[model samples]
Target: MATFRREKCTINITGTNRAVRIAGASGGFSDRQRAISSLARLDVDIIVGDWLSECTMTLHGAQKMENEKLRAEGRLMEQPAGLFDPTFIENLSPALPDIARKSIKVAVNAGACDAKLLARTVENEVKRRGLDLKVAYVEGDEVTDVVNRLIKGGEKFTSLMTGKDLKDWEYTPIYAQCYLGGAGIAEALKNGADIVVCGRVADAAPAVGAGMWWHDWNRDKDFDAIAGGLICGHLIECSAYVTGGYFFGFKRLMDGCANLGFPIAELFADGHCAINKEPDTGGKVSIGTVASQLLYEIQGPLYYGSDVTANIEGVVMTEEGNDLGMTAIGGYQAEFHVYICGLDLEAKAEWVEKQIRHSAGDAAKELSCSKFSLNGYCPDNPRNQDVATCDLRIFVQTKNKKLVDKSTLDVPGFNRWCMDNGLQGCPGWTLGNDQRQSEGKIYYEYYVSLLPQSEVQHRVVFPWLGGNTLDVKPCANMKVYPRDQPSYETSNPVNLKSFGPTTRGPMGWVVGGRSGDKASDANVGFISLLTIPKIQYLLDEEYKGGKIERFEIPGIRAVHFLLRDHLDRGFNSTSTYDTLGKNVCEYLRSKWVDIPNKFLARGRF
Candidate 1:
């Protein structure tokens, strides 16, 4: 655990650590409406949800830009509605009485561009329904003006993907929303707010704030417990993800996906918690499902949020499953991942790039970006065929609609162009049969960076206090928190033969994995390195064969991998079917590999 310092100000730690159960009712803007009413009926103290997502940022940002243009031209028709998620109002309308009846507290970041507006709306609804819920909202996430000032001061706000500076960006930024943390949300909840609304807090902030308010956890003194809340928030933030919604082992789901149950976290005051769901709900809670979200969209082992940073390297999950099938449009992309075994890794990766470029011909200029990555490491003296392979991915993004115009192209557009050199690919070359990824579509190149918490005017307002507002202080390290943390990298290889007798099979047959695209890179994560686990055993079993990075968390018996540039430009800009890369783990699971016979005997399935 790491220690974080606070400023000279004192924070009141009033509440004792007691058991608190919170239900995850929504994952994002379009989550099922049934989730709210359904979870509200459960025996939970608080209901938290995540409505903000990366694309929603793009959507709202783009909408703001468009509306500005319309206003300038006098083409604006009044003002735009639903800048915030209207779905929140719709979902909460039916769940309000249940919430009030149970005296359940609620928190959510459903406010997209405007938290005050959404909060007021919720307040009005409460009053209209003759309910007694006190509603408040956290503001100050919209930092476009602050960002502009910083730009003038020479702050680059460089892209995490490319080193391109914000000033050098092609599109004018409509707004720069800094991700606020739980402090503001906690302040509101603690100050008698029954329903807390927020705008642009991190997805996990709702839960973190609820936990902070309930347990009076000091952000600095109780760093580890706060970190536990951060991790817990991450687990159920996406609603049913930790309860088998997107489990890699969906086929093993005892209860089918129909009406899958949302997850509930029984968080203790000290931050230890067990994740469960409503009885007889369509999903199941187990170590496998929980581990998937622990790996989703994380950049590294130390997960940093606006309020606190969580160290997830040693995080663990257990099956205690008292239950649970479980079970996006964008720029078109025609792409494929190729697996090649044996030497000349980079050389062969380059060879594939050249061939694709040659095939792309003049249309290459129309491409927004194209990336070729040689992923996965092969083990020397590999025991199985899969261990000797590397994934050479050809990822391309283009906004030019003409490139995909069927009237002018043959062989169904770019897919054929990328496949033109299939015969000349790397040694022992094998490619996914799917050829739809070659198509390109319009998508925002997802960019993420940090904004100083000190610059955020985090505040909370209570509707009952005649619209009273209170400013919440930023974290102590806000002034000095680095924009970038240490990057996680892997090294020191081991041969597959070290794992004993092997059988040829898919790693998913015995293991569980979860992957998501921050729209898909080679591997999406931040900083970490650890002892190599069996994922390195089955997925990267070859000794020094490929460069696929693998990570281990001994507590949970799990290994994670990072696949660089696997998806061209991710969901917003990709034309691939696996836009969000939710299927990446499943794809890896389906790939045949040499598995240790011993472990296979005790597999999850």
Candidate 2:
């Protein structure tokens, strides 16, 4: 057994002589069986499973509350009594004996909102199977009561992403859970627990704990090591992400990815880790594969966690071995979001852009906004009166939450006002889904805030050890910075006169894209198949959007364009129909663009 002690800002590693190996099993709430089977085949010291995503937490909380209500009402059979990831038991049951025999520890966030209950269930199952596995659970991330108290005390629970307060919201939160760190998991491991379960801990916390326990690293003194572990946890937390699962060039791995092997990290004491996979398993681990996962769902260079901050801006990725890559991270925020919905209208992109500029109160002031065609109708052929309408979707974000709320709520009023002007307004003036469009529905917003380490009641509970609980707390050295607003700038004008012969076609025919939400903002990245010297014309004339940043990745032959702050307040908080911004890429792809006829002759578009 290894032990770690903190002494005056220094970490002393004792009772350990070598590097540690940790494997990531299931990524989300699916494919547990495959993950467990892979775990059985891999020779790792510990297995970290990530079962909770942002949406899953909310869903599980709602389900748990509903089940509690049913049980209180004496209708116990109305709904099944189970946690969000019940399949975890089914996945781990068959592997429990092997895991116990090999002394391979397990950690997971499968508990969702009920860590104790899930731990008890797993303990009973292990006992019934005559397995001697000790199950420990980590709690105290549930902050529903705290949130309620704060709201009662007049805390607005402002949106860290959009800077909108809770007073402007119409929906009340049913549950609130903070993202705990790996301190409790490390404490449980120290106390000889073989399996650790947690609720709403950071997605990568399990691996971080396993690394800390294996290497005898302290979070306070070994900031670099802990930060490295944090990045390692994130890289492999998604199971196959670091092993070519979600790579953009996935077609290359499709044949070998039938049973994509989960990722494993060889964590060193010096804050450097090597990412790899099980032998004879599918998926490749290379620089590109690792970089793809590193860039996934990340907002910027600074990756903040409850326990430590990982600064990956200067980190370098290089191949260390066949199917292995290595990177180091050093230690370094709180954030929350809100969603507003039911604002729908139809108009041309130019008209919508002008309207947004007018609404912002200054035509010259740069406003963060995005507009996309719903393809509901053809805008180019307005003479086809038989084609009744086209839906032009728009989204905006500002410091004024009340103004946004009012904007959505006053859709009917705006429509009436437009009708008053009659012929003066844009031709074919109309709104979509008139009834639902008039009534804006407030969504329960996600508020991200920081809690002091001293305030977090972290503990480890051993279900097998007479249900004992050991108190623990995360390191207090982490410094969180306040959330800052995203800035936007107009793209440099493009020289369109030098272009040769071209044919107009859907941009999707010649480009590939990926789009995702980042707090209140939505980022969409596009890769052009043909060499595009300048795209400012397309940005200004076709998209009529702002904050366009372009760059190129080495070894990749395409230029990439990132449109920032494009989805307003993002999913669950945005008024647009494409809340998640998933459709933004498709919308961009569907746009008509003039492509060089030479490339079209090559049959590429």
Candidate 3:
């Protein structure tokens, strides 16, 4: 049994749950090897290698289909996705080659298994073996089905309910994943499962489950007893992500990071675990980064893992100066297997493209005029279902809407230069608006999983492999493959324009419909105003003299402005308010008219 010695509080963590963190080397094979080696150093009960991804799966499926097609034509089949590489499973068994030596056990929760393929493999193994090796498989998408089935069947939560007892659990599923909580895994272990396999369980589920078994936890207990295991699992779920991948302030933990060994959960039965990496490791574990993650990455108001809802709200942390900050999580509860899942839908795809263009120095004036006349001469097919009315996208760095509007119109005149021009592919002196892709519509798909009637499948293993091969060489690959692009219906017509890259220089502001607006090339001597928009705005304000200078608001960090240059005021200026108070008041009132004085004063505005 694991135990914790707390100095300030009586912390008692109970339950069969544990977790270990592993880190990879570089990107592909090297990373896998490093991860396996890191896992080897841990004393945990189970090892989970997250290799397969949904995107990877899709790519693999497409590759397999393509390979199958080629093989039919007597052509050498191209390698399917990462299937050709053995590093994925190659690293699995090595993570702890001597686990059996220590009488310790480990299980594989296939990262993202093909449900049909895995089920068939298990069934075949069962047929081949008479060994009493207990095997268990957790479906990722069936927890809801299990809960619903229990409700309908009048089965109490306290009692053990198996999938065999459910009548409606036969729903064929594309991906059925149930995040079996630690209690469930403990029950499985108690029932004698030498090896457990699952599909799409939450990253932390297996570690927590293993910890629970190791600790011999009770099912009806409070959550704190399981919080330590839960936290440990969460830390290692993404492997090195916690150690360094996502840590922005990594310089602080550079010492304990030479070898950057994998993390370990020195878990105590009192719901507290000391998070530390392997000795001579090349990773950093500080309180700041971990706290930041706890605040950001965690999903719910209360952090919920397989067996516990760790209310990190009260998780205490202390900074040991440059050393790691010790974390103490308390006050949590377990929601059991009563997770919720909505109806499933089909997948859809979409893409977008953007383009811009402009003309060169002296020839720009003539080209601008040519484009105007050419628009009337030639036009793209106006009648196309997959297209829409094209418009000139006048992109400017200026926040000035007025300048943007003027530029939008200025682009058409660019065609005038095309007249008597020898340039061959010069858009034929046409005023072409850039074509823009439209938004995609909602797509839906039908799905079925053994949710309500699903029961736990237990005890299945084969002969040749034996229970010993729980750490066997698995045929796994992680290299991503490309898939056939899905055909999308262009319901929303795109802009009717020849969409392509353009070549042009910046446009000068038009003054009273005349070019050469200003030659105000005065250098402000400061790099701050070096941007084109700023220089233009400052020059316009100085020459035109109708500039409005806005002030920052009190108690407000940022403010939105509705600015329009080239207004009726002859000389244009930016919108600037003298008193942030009045402008802010008006702004807030416009948005919320019913806001009362007390609310505004209370900073609830």
Candidate 4:
């Protein structure tokens, strides 16, 4: 048996991006013996290879699209090779070193095809080639869907199922690899596979995979190993996320960028890994950046993976220097993963943009307001409101009646109030039809549900790097969603802001003359302040056949209140009485404005 140790590893290799002799602190395998030989040189036990990523799939899609386009244009291309899975397998074949071929375990987390397919392919190859290649299979699509579903729906929902469900879900069309982690791979290792090829496993999976092998961990075993693996995984998950992709103030450090390198996890049996990278790379390692990356895509305090609940709180990264940092992480509670289903629907129709105009109230100046009431003073008898020239709006949307209806409901009544009250031309209201709705407009929305891994089948046919494989074929399944009348509306800020005659009062409370905070309801208490002023104003104007009532800001044009309502009131109160100025400003500032910006330039209305 070969021995494994925790130490830095150096190997003679060519650079993929730059020409330099870079020593790796950890080792992983492509070819079995090559991996073992590298391990021998490094004296380490495990090696990890990153296979699948969304970015990679997107690149593949783009290439496929280009090939089809060219073929259709009569620009024929050469045939493509049938060396997809073969190349990867052949790459690993050299690992049959004299020391111990069986002892060298291999794993593949790249999912270009189904787990069963990859498993069967490798099995047949090993049998035919007479190589005792022990391999483990991890499904990538499964893990991605599991996490994605959990994020969209909570754990309270019973949408997920067990891994055994794959048997029944083998026929689904998978777009991407469903990811699994170390648990299954570890199980395969214990089951005597010298190598594991997974459909869609996570980048963090290798640590968990190796940990599972070393500890014989079950799904519910000591989660510390899993958690340790998670920490290691977090560091390496993005390949360079921890190194410098999202590094804070990264532009300030020279070593911070020019040559972004991938992360390496020098993992230990204790489940910890010293996060390092290729030497001479252009990036720095520090506590702040690593800590930030650890928090990327995090879920609950109880971090859930397909295999276990990684306790994130226990993981800690400390800064050593500009290019050095230390991570101390452990402790985990195991949790079983849930399987989930998702929809894959295409839009039946789409709405495009069109131009049109409709008239409402002629101008913003048509509005007028008094203490007790408001009037638009329009020349035409305006919509039943006591106000004369109150603003009106004509809204429209794409032919979709449903979306248009919803949009109208969402139109803020506050803008109408401002327009009716002649608060138009308020500093920030710039859109000409600002809040106006149009008629005879159409709209279309596009939506697609990302399917779960079990619902999709991936068939990865890898060709030689920079080499052609198969001849391009025209896609018979090209979908083209036709565009028609755009359902968009021009804003009518003037009329939209002046919906109703009366202004809607701000919501708050008022206390009695001597009422203490505990004794009074602040909301209703506010009714008194406006009520008193309204009554005085009405009475002074002489009960002209109508009741002396305080008018709340009109629901239609509440926006003016949003702009000048509080400002004017506080100004009036402060000017009326110095003692009340501070209290009124303080109160309004606290009660209103959710995301307040002291400076006008800092925030938008």
Candidate 5:
């Protein structure tokens, strides 16, 4: 076998300009490691990886908390606690040769808590390999200490959901990291950083930086271009997401794709980009997938980034008035999961749920939200024990952590409640060895809010410059964007009779969209090709939740719905199997909607 390498990167600087192709090499720290090497072998100019999110941040915070406690108890640790995800080095080391060979620039926010360590590690790897590559680390996303000081200096650190100050939060603050823009990333790439590792830079920041560096785009001078890059970056940051990973039409791709292809954004100087994937890959690149990623985890049309507010006005993103305030149920949450296997699964599930709730006694009444969700049913007949299983999830959210914390003597612990019913449970009763559920280690309230650009102090560390730093300033001429953009005058009427003949079918057959969370609320942007459509949601009696405010974007022929506070205070607190709200779209698609006969005739649901 011979090593394949590109002679040099093909830059598009001539009159007949070509788009700078940036491949989404990694969606997260845990994404397929082969993505970087695989995409680098293709015609990509730059490879960008995203590694931070609220979920990951919470996990990192938990790790820090655990290690602190262990050190306090004078426990011997093998490796000193890592502020950054060490997986970055694991994911990057094998791909560096290909990346360097292809002359492909790279950026990744694998620096969960420490950019310097990861950046230095990558630089050392390059040096050891004798590769001519520049490695830089973007910093200042970590601001826990700064936040604490500011809190004492009269900064409320108000909850974005409740508008209550951090002081009102019953539990002591764990840590805070601010969301940063692409400015720091762009600076690194422009200053000749072949590889840029970052911490807490926005998910799409890698792509945004690549586009800015490739096009020489100034945020203030090129707002639309910047916004365009922002939107493009948003669309492809989730790797295969916009190319059929969470798509409604996933079955169609299952025929050929063993795995979905990582997304690549075809970046142009004008700001607009075309999203595609490597040819012959498992997934597809279509309007449905692109729109699905666009609507993922988004709040409204005015998509605010630290650098610029990218308005999705013409493409039609909007949110009807939300009942969004003080929706955090009890704040602190305690949860436990028990898997039932083999025969009498339902009976076993019932026993666990029943006993867990009953054991709480009087304290159960005080819970803001108590949900016992029976998820995943075992199939009938002819399968192994592993296949014949279902999960019994017990969630308790209350104002006080002690109510859920297993160590507290305040009330009966959820873990104890779950385990005590083991003997009484049905034939398949089982419990996991993980004691954290009982210990209340799985409880945390997630809050999302913005910090000023000045506060973040976005900067880059150049390893080639002997660890010298460069400050990346926010846009000088930033625009004050209005919260609401003009929604297309598409009327979303719920009159089922208006569409003439109707048939009961899964909503998936008629339309496609994406669902994700903005804090606790789930936003599902429903896209349909037809306008003047009459649709109604026929949720059964089992449905119980907050107001679903619906809006329509005639331009894109999409109906957007915000399921206010649907996730039980979002991912960390939510007992739902689909913590990120990624499954909401598919779940809604599975619902039997009154599909117009014309849509059925068209055979494009």
Candidate 6:
């Protein structure tokens, strides 16, 4: 509860080889309490907290708008305070004195969309306790007006995921934010600020900014070092993620990992970093743990950031001893996903494709569609056979963004045409989810793409320092490259009849899997409970020439399949049934796969 008197101070560092140890306190709002504890216990120069995710921003924005509406209607007293993460003040209040006493700087993106307001809240809290913590925030990421102006000027504001213009969207976006880099945070620290809050920055921006401030790294001349810091930021950006929290081998670390410690990175001037956690805290930090995190949600090998692109293709992972994990950094056109449902009983996938082609014309030139039959109509019990209607789901893919958008926009017309031909269709011409089917859902998939660093505006606002702002620019030495696609191999011919007596059951019976969206692509990684050869045989016979491509990570006992052009440009803009790719694995699991009786006899399935 102690507080320090306010003092104006400037941070001046004069060391090239000095190393900075920064801790990632919170991954998101849920980790508030634990994150605060890390600041109290860990010996670090700075603590970086990340509380903003894409979903959190949207939800928080909606809540703020709702509160404003209620206020206008006289539903409450004065407007509620703190539009940023609600728990930010609660978590940081108690630790302010300790942070001040220890002379440690704090940088976080807990501000979400309202950095200035969040900064004011933090400033108020500090003053309430008689503390003089200089709080600063970075702005300019809020691009609603910028977007509107661009749209007015006839700029498409094309989606990076779907490559479609936002002009075609039926509804205007609530807000459009650009992902900023770490230069702003670094600038804030340089100008005597103790705490830096930001809005919608790249997840690792804080770490990168802290590195820049600590080392005085030149933005133009230090591309390698900056890239290195960017990598470090990514490693610990999710707190416990680098410390065995979400490792594929979670079971092995379960005993002590329940209270997993947040991650800290000891970053060198050269950009190399070592990740660890507070002493006596739970969770393991090893090669596997770090590698798992490094690969999480990544698209192609090249990891793009607002400041630098880290090539991870040749990154080496090795163990220093028993507990530490190390990695060496190094350095695509993607596809969109279309989900079609509620087909008439007589409707065939080929017919649906023809109709789509006709509606789309040249737009559907290179597009490919894959059909899936939902044999049962009952959402409550998918296995029930007594349902009156079933659904035909089609997944369409192409590199053409306009074609995808047009196909989606033309769904109503397609449905009308189908209903008109119902009499000529099959005997049991029925459809489910009539309303949703009539309004076709299309998603523009996300893929890793690059933009010039010069285009990004990075700036810091010093609220405590009379609201002055400093601008930061991207490195002049940086080079941008297009993302590469994953190379796929054709499935080896397999004679399923050669395998002994088989049981036709859901694929999940023999395989446990996980699926997620990487930009626009859907990555489904599954482990075989049975032998690899048998699983290979099943995949070869079942998934050949499908939109998915199968590959293996030899280090882990798992097979992963990348569903190219899946998820319709990713979660943000995807209108697909499964926007997050969360259902891909479950749906595949529900599909019947012929399993060898030998494995079933062991009861493993």
Across 341-410, the per-residue lDDT of candidate 1 in tens digits comes to 8877778777778887788777777766566767788788889887888877876655445663332123
lDDT for each residue of candidate 5 in 188-292, tens digit (9 for 90 to 100):
988988888888877877887887888888766777677777787787788888778877777777875677778777777777777778766777777667767
Query: In model 1, which regions exceed 4 Å deviation?
Result: 1-16, 162-172, 314-443, 477-495, 498-500, 519-550, 564-566
Model 3: weakest 10-residue lDDT segment is 510-519
Model 4, span 1-605: residue lDDT tens: 00111123433323332111111211122222233234323333454555543333323323444455777897856753221233455544444452144254555564344455555566676667676555445442433344345435632211111112222321222222334446566656665656666654555666667666765544444556556665666555555555665443355455547555545555444555566554555665555345435544332233444444454434421111000000111111111111111111011000000011111222212212112111123345445433332222222212222222222212242233223423322221112333333122221111112232233322222211122122212112222211111111123323323433322222222111110000000111121123333323422432222211111212111110001111121211111122111223123322322121222223221
The worst-scoring run of ten residues by lDDT in candidate 1 lies at 318-327
lDDT of 3 at 56: 33
Please count the clashing residue pairs in each candidate, in the order shown: 54, 7, 61, 92, 3, 12
Model 2 clashing residue pairs (backbone): 335-448, 336-447, 336-448, 337-446, 339-572, 339-573, 340-573
Q: Return whichever of 4 and 5 wins on lDDT.
A: 5
Candidate that scores best on TM-score: 5
Candidate 6, residues 1-605: lDDT per residue as tens digits? Answer: 00011112112335667578788888778774757655655567999988976556655555555576788899955757566888888888888888888889999998976888889889898999998789999986655555556557776554444445555543445445567788889989989999999987888889989999998988766766777887889878888877877555666677887677777777778787777676666777776566556555555445566766665543422111000000111000122222223434345444544554455455445444423333344345434344544555543443332343444324453344344444444444344443443443432222232223344455788775577778775555545343343544324545667878899887766655556665566666566433334434544433333254454444445555665666654554544567667666566666677888876776542
What is the lDDT for 216 in model 3? Answer: 64
Candidates by lDDT, descending order: 5, 1, 6, 2, 4, 3
Total clashes, candidate 3?
Answer: 61
- Please name the candidate that would achieve the greatest lDDT relative to the true structure: 5
lDDT, candidate 5, residue 457?
69
True-vs-predicted CA distance for residue 1, candidate 5, Å: 43
Candidate 3: regions farther than 4 A off: 1-31, 41-46, 52-87, 115-178, 183-195, 253-259, 314-605
Candidate 6 lDDT (Cα, 0 to 1): 0.62
**Model 5 residue 365 lDDT?**
69
Comparison by TM-score, 1 against 5, better one: 5
Q: Provide TM-scores for the models.
A: 0.74, 0.67, 0.41, 0.38, 0.82, 0.64
Candidate 4 whole-model C-alpha lDDT, 0 to 1: 0.35
Q: Tell me the deviation in Å of residue 336 in model 5.
A: 5.3
